[model samples]
Target: MRAPRDKVIITCAVTGNLTTPDQTPYLPITPQQIADSCLGAADAGAAVVHIHVRDPATGRPSMALEYYQEVVERIRAKNPELILNITTGPGGRFVPSADDPKVAAAGTTLMVPEKRVEHVTALKPDICTLDLNTMNSGKEVVINTPGNVRRMAKVIAEAGVKPEIELFDSGDIALMNDLLKDGTLKGPILCSFVMGVRYGFQPAPETVIYARNLLPPDAEFTAIGIGRAAFSSVAQSYLAGGHVRVGLEDGVYISRGKLAASNAEMVTKARRLVEDLGGEIASFAEARRIVGLAPYSATRAA
Candidate 1:
């Protein structure tokens, strides 16, 4: 068994690429709301806030740099201590056309690898996600080819930001190990296991244990559950010597027949759960040290 961590880090994925406003009225769409939600999650004991921006008017996921700048500025103005983890998860989904399998369908967001991390390069956050999955999602496939991932990693490295490797299956873990071996990604890595997605790593204790065992000795991981598994994975991940994550992006409901009123509500529950489990929540500074992030002032000046 991996040694248990003294302090648990709760990461709140305030908004994600796939989650829509229609799924939950409480989902933050505007820059102001996203920033406000992030700040609230921080106040409720989340040391890190995972972010994705959406179009203000239509509530569609956007890769616009302007929106990211606005949200980051707003959050930093309020609480610079909260670690910001921006998403590079957009612009990777592929929906093939019915007539021409090679051609992309209307929902396809696939773009050049460089285009995907444009915001991360320009508005460098403390950490940015680097997805390593090429998996089937319903009828569509999310593609993150190895070569493209390296190209994105190069840009992320140049920006001096930490890459939070998001693993969806056992293969992604294998790929991460390879990346480490080949020096594509540096060690003392930070990663997350995204559970409960259809055809991805299912939410289970064994799955968490299995994935956790595959990671490098120094890797810091969080196991995130989607839909019904969200809260349960908080305890599952913690017990398995990993961190936890929760937000509307992973699930809309906090409990059966009830929606989480805000991301802060979800973080509050996660905090209570961890404390109940005899684990103390990591403060922002402690989490930064654990994740190898520079202090807030140092990051800003970079």
Candidate 2:
């Protein structure tokens, strides 16, 4: 088992692809709202903010480059020091048609892997998620085939942005090792165990330990709990030598009954959890150094 970290990195996923305004009225739908939530999370204690934009009018998940550009620009204008980890996870889901299982249904978003990372290529955020799972997510399937993952990785690498491998299960971790071995991905990698997704990795203390053991010795990781496991995973992850993540993207409830007022509120609870466990939250510079990323100014020059 890995030893505990000296400084734990708290990453706040301000908004996600699947969460909707109906789930919580506080969900950040517009670009301005998303940017404001991110800055608030950073101030609350998150070193890194994982972003996903949505349609302003419909509040549906959007892969529009302009939306992403606006969010990144707004975040940079206010807090260049805060790490930006954008999502390239929206366009990989496949919904098979009942009439023809081989054909895609209305919700299918599978597209050229290059199209998925277009914003990452353009904005060149400090980090972007590279989902490595091809699993059954509820009624739909999230497909990140090995070949497509390589294609996406190539675009992310070309952009000079670090890809935080999002591992949904143990198999994804194995695939990550293979990618690292083949040079499809670089070493000292950053990854996260996305627990509590149905049919994927379940959240538990032992689950965290098992996934942690499978990672490369030098790899950095975070164990993120989705839904009810959200806050619990923060303590579990830190005690097991990994970092922590929490936000609206992962879950909405701050306590047993109440919904979180904002993304910053979630981060506040996560910070207290880590501190209660005797872990120190990593600062902006500390997190950059830990993840092997350059400072904001240096990244801008590239």
Query: What C-alpha lDDT do the candidate models reach, one value each?
Result: 0.93, 0.94
In candidate 2, stretches whose alpha carbon ends up further than 4 angstroms from where it belongs are 298-302
Error of 1 at 263 (Å): 0.3
Model 2 lDDT per residue over 1-302, tens place: 68889999999998898788889999999999999999999999999999999999899999999999999989888898999999999889899999999999999999999999999999989999999999999999999999999999999999999999999999999999999999999999999999999999999999999999998899999999999999999999999999999999999999998999999999999999999889999999999999999865745743
lDDT of 1 by residue, 97-167 (tens): 99999999999999999999999888889999999999999889999999999999999999999999999
TM-score of each: 0.98, 0.98
Q: In terms of lDDT, which candidate is strongest? A: 2
RMSD of each: 1.2, 1.2
lDDT of 1 at 109: 93
